[model samples]
Target chain A: MGHHHPGSVSPLRTLTAAVRHHRDRNVGPVKTVKLPRRKLDFFASVLQRFGELHAPVARNGHFVFQRVRRWSEARLEYTRTELPPKKYFLPPRETLFRFTPGKGYVPESEDLDRRIVLLGVHACDIYSLNILDLVFNGKYPDPYYQTRRRNIALIGVDCIPDQRCFCRSMRADTVEQGFDLFFYDIGDYYLTLVGTALGDDMVLAAGELFESVTPDDVAEYKRRSQERHQRFQLDVEIRDLPEIFEMEYGSEIWEELGAKCLSCGSCSMVCPTCYCYDVADETQLGSTAGRRVRTWDSCLFATHAAVAGGENFRHSRASRVKFRFYHKQRGFVAEYGRPSCVGCGRCSAVCPVGIDIIEVINRLRGVEYAETEHAATR
Target chain B: MQATKPTVGIFGLTGCAGDQLVILNCEDELLSLVDVVDIRDFLMAASGGDEFSTLDIAFVEGAVMTRRDEEKLQRIRRRAKALVAIGTCALQGGVPAMADGLDWPSAVRDVYGPEGDGFDALPARALHECVEVDFSLPGCPIEKHEFLGAVADLLNGNPPQLPTYAVCTECKMRECDCLLVDQGRFCHGPLTRAGCRARCPSYAVPCVGCRGPVPDPNLGSAMDVYTSKGWSPEEVVQRLRTFGPLPTPVPAGEAA
Candidate 1:
């Protein structure tokens, strides 16, 4: 029912043990283990024994990560999920505290010790999770988020870039770490790379299903990675994006975008790294006792910037639109040394009005032009 | 000392009494609600003599279409301390308000006869237009949870917090695939107010703007999306008009 705690040993001893384990097998820290296509179900079933299993599944012609009981339910070949894996860590709504009228509040902390294995996560979403880690785990760490992150294990899968995906431009098309295990499709088998000790534990649990990878298999894995790199349909030059955003602060493009913005907050809702939230108290009918809950909020909403004095910081649609972009592209980088956007394309895919991030970035760079025909007709 | 329960009334005017029925649909919570509020007037669920003297809170549903409907609404507004417009009809005039664009007299005559079949008719108007409405709970049929929550908030001397965001927000939370983006369907989710938990999208149907538009919807952009997807400007307006006409009128014969 439980596994040995890695923390029980000293950091030096743990590293030495890992090194000894790898040397004993004559493998590098990044070893490629061959998983035969037929053994996927057996492997998933074995993984399920470790924790609550979740994977992407086909729903209403789109993919969404949902709890899966069977291996067959996991749609491993899907391009993108309607919602990112962020929901597992930071749910849409969660109770923060409960309070009675006279009595003070009692914090409703979650039990984060329960094991959860998220399978079939794409590279961009994994990168997004890493960005979230920097936000929630940095400075004054959020205990709730930190605990949930500690309990969950991420399993990454190589994704075939769709027309909407621009992860390559963000340098998030492939991840080196932050995942327990990463799977790459190499013809008849999956070349699985163990990224962490937890991944090594998983491999040991289902050792029979995996075989030591040969040199030929490693070559095939590298060739497949190269092939996927060229398949991306969208690209954005992100090196000087922060500078461009700074210069384009007063660009007319924002006003044009604001005119088309629905202000629905769908873009933020679907974005993996957008973690803005609002808290409210919900009391029971005819009772003084209630729970304070936190729900996902968006800066795009009109009331998001409103204060008690009726002063709204970002009053106009243009300001809100610009603020959202600048926050993701420039502001985050100034604070975190990296842009918050992982180029997952969920925002573009979910936007009702077809506001693509790549187009916005390219237009900002003066490399592309907006469709003037539509604007002129309007 | 036991606290006196607040007197409440539930009334309907000129549309399908679906919203009141939704209140009845809250079978589990209905009993608890009854224990909390003193329901003085509720015609749909329970039959009682009209005691419209003074109500702590009144939930009025349906649109005010006729002279009698307007008078009844005014009477309710006078009696009730706080009037909450429940359902799309009372909030935005609902589907019945579509007749506002047409010649009412001719439409009424065509429906009935030259010698009118008795009841006087007028253009469908929202309750707020006729009387002072304290709050509004908007939806095709008001969501049961929202209705109950509003009632609870009023009982607790708290203003009921309503969602200002569009249906697209809830649709995204439900993780439903964007019909407009994926299939190029004319979904009104972006423009329409939420609080229905995106029921239509969850069931694979596009939002029909039945909950009415959000506070500051960019209709121009919404129409642009539709027109770009090959939908005619007339088609877009027709769809928008299905629930009720927007506050800013879509120009006549203009391709969006």
Candidate 2:
């Protein structure tokens, strides 16, 4: 229902429109190309020239984004990675600067500009990256994140909807921008969308590898898109979700969820968009020299709100859980005209306990039967 | 340099001296450590010490399991400027205190026969139960880096900062897949204190909560989570008791 605007455009719709405008204004008209499915393996070698090629690979019966020497090592059809491509930009831990008492502070700039080509990114992930760009590219831009973003190239690929996926409900199933190149598998070929001049250059470099799309190919694309859309078993109505979240601020459901929450922060770490970090000055054992390090932080942690005076703003676990939801679904919408969550289902899948976003939202809306039924079968 | 350095002492009570061993295991840092601090008392590492002298900092490991242990802890607390309880035994009653609620006299009799009656033993309890503990560095065996960090902080005249968050924070940072969610493993990482850097989980092993409980843990809900995976409540409690005494379960709907 949220996907279909009946009378007037919503704030998120306006944001999406603005995103489209921004993309078109910067890249001119969208150029479509085709690459034979068999040629993809050979194209991986060509991609290496641009940067260190990283793609999803199997690890311990799960998928992880790792550097691959050969295309055979990459698992393009992976449902999700243990950690998102955001790690390549924000990193789990990074040194911001090194300081000495008398010598002053020296900025850490090592490997800030390492070129990386992230292949097989999902649409929701690319959309999440765009959201990250909004946060990091503000007035006081983070030089670290910005530099990494500039150096890394994204090549998104279409994904098959899993039981956990709810990206369609979040309006992130298809991305209009934020990726240099996007590939959609269609039988024997990949319908590629060149999103930028850099992407166009890649196509140019590939030369004979790419071909023009045909009318039959366009019809096939429409058919596959419909099939993909219908395959999404999980859906959450985002219409007036921010308002619902505001009304349910004192809902007892938070207590129940918080009681069940382990607060391990696995969901936040695996998330494509969660970007909160904590900074600390880690001094050497015997020297005055220390490096100011930044590490990933989660609102769910007990110490997230702890201050110098030993007063915790969100001391209660229930309040911390509520804070995470309110920020992603309510506060973020107020500021960015869109929700921060892309519904990538990483939080749901990675949670040790069954604290699913879809189930939680459905429960809040008082339509819990569908998700409950699906969960029972799962 | 030794005269200019701060005086420190390391003492053990009754539990296994694993925590002190972790300090000695700091092979690389130990040489530099002696140069920076005046380690006046360390029975395991040195021959003699002036027990009457005041210390700038005192690191006490193990729990108060005997009347003598309690008396010794009180003496250490009185002479030290600041006392830090090291390891789970000194913070929470670790594996040693798991027998606290059991029939200790009969249990000891079974282990040592009639000779056990001669052995005088009080209920095993953490050092804080008998004496004031200024700080605590909790782990089954205190982590080597954590001990080194505490010493480093003491050398700079700063209070040692320890992780207040749970083991899950470090586990996630390491990007280890959720063993509990994915494989139905009963990991206590969510409730356990951090600072071991998630050593077990990184190797595809579940945490046994050797670091003790984090602040405001949801105990009842954690039980429910484990029970749902076919583990009985008693079994869950049994697994938890391997490291430390079980805390009272915080019920659902209660703010934790």
Candidate 3:
């Protein structure tokens, strides 16, 4: 029902009435703000006013999320940022501690007090961050990652998939949670859904820049969401993934993947949820003072599974390939009750040799397709 | 008491001495490094002696493109306890290796005319082909940080950490846009080894793979990206062959 007229009631009174109605409903309030397409840049600038704003920008003919100096630099329509937003939380190279050769190691603390606004994040990436939160914040929590996570804010936006994207299959195409704010393009206005209190605070802070969403805006948002779902070209039935991975442990598909895989570690590096790391100590050139650093490590490396005794647990290429898939699909679910892959299509996009996850899943299902041979070679 | 510093030598052969220049470019760290390691021989930085001497570590640059180069590499290998190949030219035969499949004599004649007869040259080959290499630090011009880090590792009795991943790893870390996917450019980042910190991509240039191919580079997938972008198989192969040897040839009868 559209609220076309409020009998000349004050805007604040109308807002209070709406909030009270939502409170009475005994459910979390869903607040939506509308920003005209022309004012999208204004909203971005507003975000920048608060803290460092990172959004997708064109770099060397490709789109990457970089620190923006101006609102015009942000590419809201981008399909995907080359790398996921995980780098902000968990950097590739991070100092864990500083140590003296004879003395014990001293833990290195980072300054995570600065505010950072991650803008234009895709729904898939938001989902990926949620998955990372579970891992980093569970059991023995990572203080460095946790500190950084707390300092940064997330703002998600809707994305149109290229053929490579399979987030829909993984139920990551639209996120119900994990973002402070989620934006959906509806005609000339952006329908901004305030998912958290932080999002509401942001909306309130920039109150003059946004208006309350109309009933027509809501309808348009729903229509566009439906359209986005239908547009996805790739789909994997994730419900069957655990069973499929378990049953296909001895399948020849892994061998095919092994043949195609270079084990160059591109897929995992670009993946938002791949969080394995290797820690090393580096002594200074002349001094005994040194720092201990941890760097991103990939499961695909032959030495990744190698033990101190020189026995490699997952020695064969086929085994490593199988291990990676099983870890993401079956093992992760077994441990965390969910698959690790959010299906952002980064692995497929960056796999120099075309080892697409969708195609692999299809082939695992024995789907007769001409592209299977080509994918196998890739 | 002056503790005996680990003896180290820097040598170059038949390519651009860019890798050595990169080491010298480490202006801040260079002076401090000399205190940790003995600079037995560094012709580029010093001219103490040309004669080969026993050393604890030898950092060799360039590729072996002649009998003299091969002999020099063997001598270094014999004298040094550890030999580190510095730069793509030394590690993978680099630009010099591009002439491998071509007729050497004719190629040389084409470049130098009849006067090329006076020059004696051989097909370019990696240093490891002639002698054992303890480690390899690969790049067009080796990343200064990596060089410094590797030397530090060796001094500490730790094996120098080299990147086992592709250039895509660094590119992703740097958050540089994927040229291959977004712009349909033939970037070899996913197939090339990392350590250059995605330099080319950071500046918006396509990765020409100056760091050489990763140990298990997925050449087929790299080719697929190019082909999907409307590049011919020949064009893909040619682009790939620019930095390192092609993994496989595009079969005959494929559209050029």
Ranking by DockQ: 2, 1, 3
lDDT of 3 at A182: 80
Ranking by TM-score: 2, 1, 3
Error of 2 at A168 (Å): 0.9
lDDT of 3 by residue, A170-278 (tens): 8788777777788888989888888777777788788688888888888988898877777776666677778977888889888777766767677888899998887
What DockQ does each listed candidate score? 0.49, 0.54, 0.38
Deviation in angstroms for A305 in model 2? 1.9
- All candidates' TM-scores? 0.90, 0.91, 0.82
The fnat scores of all predictions, in order, read: 0.74, 0.53, 0.65
Task: For residues A167-206, write the lDDT of model 2, one tens digit per residue.
Answer: 9889999998888899999889999999887788788889
Off by over 4 Å in 1: A1-32, A106-114, A369-378, B1-3, B50-52, B248-256
Give the TM-score (vs. native) of candidate 1: 0.90
Could you give the CAPRI-style class of model 2? Answer: medium
Off by over 4 Å in 2: A1-30, A371-378, B250-256
Q: Give the higher-DockQ candidate: 1 or 2.
A: 2
lDDT (10s digit) by residue, model 1, range A1-378: 011111221123322333333212112246568789889888898888778899999986789998898778899999888889888877887775678978877656544456788999998998898888787656545555656676678888898887777788788888887888888888889889888877888999997889989999989988887777777667678888999999998899898888778899999999999988777778888887888766788889888888767888888988999999999999999999988999888888777767888889889998863333222343
When just chain B is superposed on the true chain B, each candidate scores a TM-score of 0.93, 0.94, 0.93
